[model samples]
Target: MRAVVYDTYSQDLSSLEVREVPKPKVGPGTVLVKVKAAGVNPVDWKVMAGYLDPLMDAYFPVIPGWDVAGVVEAVGFDTPEFHVGDEVMAYARKDVVQGGTFAEYVVVPAKAVALKPAELSWEQAGGLPLAGGTAQRALDTLGDLDGKTLLVHGAAGGVGSLAVQLGVARGATVLGTASEKNFDFLRGLGAVPVAYGEGVVERVLEAAGGKVDAVADFVGEQLETTLAVLADGGKHVSIADGGVAEHGGRYVWVRPDGGETARLGELAASGALKVEVAQSFGLDQVAQAFALSQSGHVRGKLVIVP
Candidate 1:
């Protein structure tokens, strides 16, 4: 099988090579999937460049991706939940960064896989796992938002867009920060849009009528701003910044939860959630895909057809 492999961490794209590698053997309680598509995320490049070296282990010749959508080709021993030909999606991050979903085939724990929603295209399904799981984790960290007001920074991006829709579904009034170009996009997701540059606090205050009961920061470096606008005793969480914990807020690192992934699939199937694919590239063009993800300005998800 062919995959995108990196033998060492390098900022330059030269380290990534598309080449043949031995197929992964299925393990107990896991399923082997015939790869259809994979989602490109900023973390893929960041990890490749050694940003996460102190935190996670990277097995050399690593394949870089966590989000995948594909058809089940075989089930490992005792994995009775799925069989050959079941369409599925998963957040397939393992503790070690190897055997990722950037190839002709990949293996994932059955528990980490969710049946793909029939309503979603393969690209959307592949893009759904990581961002959707992050959004759901943010909402979970905040507890009940019913009848409250919430603010999301960078709400037009992959995770933020899903956060807006999920927040609104929980009966909270969601106000999202983005550029003027994405205000309409945020509004379309049921959020009141506030421009994120100068005077952002005042703009958000105006949009929320002077109340921000909670906040989820998808964009980093906003701890001070979050402290300024958040209501006293209100809750907040940041996925990008660890400094949030010092300010009485939580720092979230999204983890794979089969139950939560399944819930997200159900939401998409019911038409209550949507995923936007900003652009897609063939598997061999993964370097180009990573460049686009690193730009940090894409309005939605980027996917790779493998």
Candidate 2:
């Protein structure tokens, strides 16, 4: 099978190259998927640059991705949850960094695989897993948002946009922060929009009619603003900042859950939740995709057709 592999960490994109590699063997309780598409996330390149080195182990010749939407080709022993020809998607992050979804094929634990909704395009499904999972996790951490006011920083981003939709579905009036160009986009997602920089707290407070009941920080480095805008006794969580824990807010790292993935697929299938794919690239052009992701200005997800 062919895959994009990086043998060593480098800030430069030169380390990533496509090459023929040995096929991954399906393990017990796992399924081998023929990769149709993979999502290119910030973590993919961050892993390549060793930014996550302290958090996870990396094996050499690592394949660089975790989000996938593909068809099952085979199943391993005791994996009764999936079978051949089943379409699935997953946030298939392994404890070790290797055998990633960027390849022509990837072996995933059956517990991590969820049926991909037929309504979603391959790119949309591929891009949905990680970002959607992260957004879901953040919302879950905020718990009981019904009839409350929720604020999402970087709300036009991949995770933040989805968070807005999820919060709205739970009966929360959502306030989202983004650049002027993305205000319309956030409003389309059912969020009250506020400009992100300079006096954002005042804008959010004014928009929310006083204070926000909950806050999800998808973008980092705004502890002061979050503190100021939050209502007394409100909940706050940050996926991007560990410092949130120090300030009595929760710090979240999204986990892979098949149930959550399936629920998101249902929402997408029902046309209640939408995954916006900003751009896509062929497998050979992954380097360019990673470069775009690192720029941090992309409005939605980027995908690779493997």
lDDT of 1: 0.91
User: Per-residue alpha-carbon lDDT of model 1 for 200-252, expressed as tens digits?
Assistant: 88888888888599999999998877988999899999999999999899998
Model 2 residue 8 distance off true place after TM-score fit, in angstroms: 0.8
Model 2 spans with C-alpha error above 4 angstroms: none
What's the C-alpha lDDT at position 147 in model 2?
A: 95
RMSD of each: 0.9, 0.9
Provide the overall lDDT of each model, using Cα atoms, as 2-decimal numbers: 0.91, 0.91
lDDT of 2 by residue, 1-306 (tens): 989998888888977899999999988989999999999888898899998999999899899999999999999989988989999999899889888999999998888899999999999999998999999999999999999999999898889899999999999999998988988898898999999888888898889999899999999997899999898899999988899999889998877778889999999898888998999898789999998988878898999998
- TM-score between model 2 and native: 0.98
TM-score of each: 0.98, 0.98
